[model samples]
Structure formats: structure tokens, C-alpha cells
Target: MAFFGFKDIDKLSEVDMAIYRYIVDHDEQVPLMRVRDMAKGAHVSNSSVMRFIHKIGYNSFPEFKVSFKNENQDLMRSQQNILNIFTRDAFPHDIEKTIKLVAHLMLDADNIVFFGMGGSGAIAEYGARQAASLGFNSFAVKDPFYPLIAQLQNTSNNVIITLSVSGKTSEIVETLNNFVNSPDTILISVTGNIESPVARIGRYALTYNVPETRIHKYYDLTSQVPCVYIVDGLLMELHNQDIERQK
Candidate 1:
């Protein structure tokens, strides 16, 4: 089976999910298929296939194929590993409490600031955009200086979310440290390492642990997936809360 099956299908766009479904239904042929071949079978463009692979956390088609083969060789073991990875780390009961708390904070906050660097920075920007779409006043600060300034200017009604895969990025840690004693502003950290500096200092930390692999040494993948998933879950919960209040 393709490794993409391990991801949350609801997180995919309609077109991407359609392509993913096609691949899942044709699992027997997927290992032998090329990007172009998969696109043809799914009636999607080659670029669509490429995007789908990246969205599902693979850096490239070849990387995806190799992992798919290894995972499929021992499907039961692979599925269990995936289940443990997500359930134990990503969707644990504490994550629900964190999302609920974030939803409440966002609903009442005057502003929301998202901070990160590198791949985590990109995910931070995406999360900020998602929050804005959900009607929150949000800003994404990828630069270290901007977050420092934001922290200096924002009041207690502000909410800050920092994204760091390792939770030990120096700039992010320093930024969180600046807010360590702030009484009014709330800090939330989304990270892969709960014990890292940023997570330890934040008011609330959402942790998602993906097993380190040989592929990770060469390609920074899967780290963003859990972050994005947490952001989406928070947004969805906030939306639901809003609808309930309206009712």
C-alpha cells in the first residue's frame, strides 16, 4: 500500500483526494507506476501527481516509491507503526484539550501572531492564512526581528503560536523566552519535541512525534504534516464553537 494512505484524507483538497483515492484503489499497480502513469490513471496532470506526493509528505516520486515498497512488504507492521505515530503523538486526548483552549483564545484574542523559521516558518505562514480565512486577525512573522517587535507591541489580548519541528531553534527559543513572563499574552507552541526549549517555555505546547528516519537526514518531511493538522483541527474546532454560539 502507498504511504499516503497513512495520512488524513480529510486534509486533502477534493482533486488531490480524488487522485489519492485512485492510487489507493490501484495499490497493486502503484509501486510500478511512474508519475506520468499515475496522473494518466487518475485523470490528473503530472504536476498534480507531483503535488499530491509532496502533500502526502514525500520529497519526490522515487522517495515515495521506496518507502511504499518497504511499508507494503510488511503492511501490518507498517500500519501499526503509523497508527502509533499519529495516535500517540498527533491526535492524543491532550491535543483535543489544546485545540479547545486555542479555539477559546482565538475567539477572544485581539490579534494572533504566528512565528517560526525555515520549513516551520512556511507552515506558520500557512497557519496564519488559515486563521485569517476563519475570521481571526492573524499575522505570520517568519523573521526573528519581527516577532520580537510584535511581542514588544502586542498586549495581553494577543495570542502567539510558535512552530518549530525540533522545538529547539535558537531564534524561536529566544522569541518565546522574551514572552516567558508576559502576563496577558498567551503563547502556544506546536513542535515535534515536547522537551525542547520553545515547548517547555510556552503556556501550552502541542507535540507531534514522527519517528526519525534515514530519509529525514536528507529530506525534511513529515514534520510539517502534524503542524498543519493541528492548525486545521484548531480552526475547525473554532468554527464549530462559533456556530454553536450563534445557535
Candidate 2:
């Protein structure tokens, strides 16, 4: 009686689904199995099992398995929780990963500018102010189409950090691609998928890897927190850098 079967269904490819299913079915008085044993049970290769764990938001098989056994709820509750975490939706793992990347990017970038549209755009603006306090020149590019032109006209050596949840926005994609050759313009994308169009064009992509369920449906602020927290992480890391520099 593993709790929920699986959520973030789209996040899991075919192999991940199979592996997860195998884990659920074998949980009661489960055998002590190595990765190889687990993979064999799942009808997947060992490498595939490990990859599947990461893809579905687990740091490792042991960590995932531990959580899988935490609750004593029935299979239905388990299934529901999976949905709640991934789709319906409370997604801690995705959010945590996003925060981690933002902190890293903030420390790494020479200068920071943010780009997004609609709600994500609003968040980018908020991120800019937050970053600015840390002595980084931060701007939220309002019009995705004209950012490159504006960047060319400005005389600062700064990187552009674009936030796109879906990574499919054509205008942002084009804007980022337009500046591919500019040494002054280093592109860092905070996007949800490694396979997204924006990730493809950016100089460096800090992928968020949101639950597939979060991406497929409409939600008010579920996805925004991941990106915002990323900015917050960046700000915190910047503070640390300042402390180090002052020492």
C-alpha cells in the first residue's frame, strides 16, 4: 500500500512511470534491493532508475523511498498526495530546486537583468528590486521584443536573466536569441524545462524543472514561487559574496 501512485505524470517519461509503479506494488515487506535489483524489478536499467528518480523530483532513490513510506494512508490518499504535490498542487521539490539555482546564478552573474511577461513579468520586476538592493544593477525588461535593442544602446557589461515558466514564449525566445553574439549580453534563463525553446537559446539556463502537472494547467501563483525564490536565493548569495569581498 504505497500512498499515491504518481503525480507529475508529464514530468515522468514512460520509464519513470513504470519504475514508480514497481516501487508502489512491492512496498509491503519489500526486499532489500540495490539499484540493480530495483531496476530489474522496474523492468528498466539501473541508470534509467536513477535518472527516473531525479526526473520525478527525488534527490536519490533512498530519499524517495523514505518519503514513500512515511505515510500510512491508503493507496488512494497516496495517489491524492502525489497529485497535490505535483499538479493540484503543492510542489516543494520543484520550488526548492528553483531557489537553489537562483542563488547560484545571482552569485555568478556580473550584472543582472530580468525578462518575463504577464504575471511572470511582474515577478521579474519584483526580482529586479530585490537584486538591486544587493548592489547588482537589476532591470526587468518590460517589452520582450525591444529588450535587445535597449541592451545594445546601454553601455553596461551585464547578463540578462529571463524567467519563463513554460519557456515557449516566442517574443522572449527571439529577444534572447537576437543577442547571441554580444559579449556584453550573457543570457541566463530561469525556465521550467531543459527542453524548452528559451533554454535552447539562452547563454546559460537555470532550469526550474516544475512538476509537469503544474505546467499543463492554469494556476495562480504555484509556479511563481519557484521563480521568485530563485531570485531570493540570488539575492542571498549576493549578500554572501559581498561579505566575502569585504573580508
Please tell me which predicted candidate would have the highest TM-score against the true structure. 1
Instruction: Report lDDT (CA) for all predictions.
Output: 0.80, 0.69
lDDT of 2 by residue, 1-247 (tens): 2226455677777888898778778876233567888898888898998897777667877776676666433444647644333341333346455545555556656667778888778988888888887777677876876545665556546667788888888888777776788777667777777789887886566666455454446653445666665666666766876678689
**Shift of residue 132 alpha carbon in model 1, Å:** 0.8
- Report the lDDT tens digits of candidate 1 across residue range 86-141: 55434456788888988888888888888888887898888889889888889898
Model 1 scores a TM of 0.62
What RMSD does each model have against the real structure?
11.8, 16.9
lDDT for residue 201 in candidate 1, whole number 0-100: 88
Q: Write down the TM-score of every candidate.
A: 0.62, 0.54
Off by over 4 Å in 1: 1-91, 150-154, 213-219
- Which residue pairs show backbone clashes in model 2? 3-78, 4-78, 4-79, 84-90, 103-233
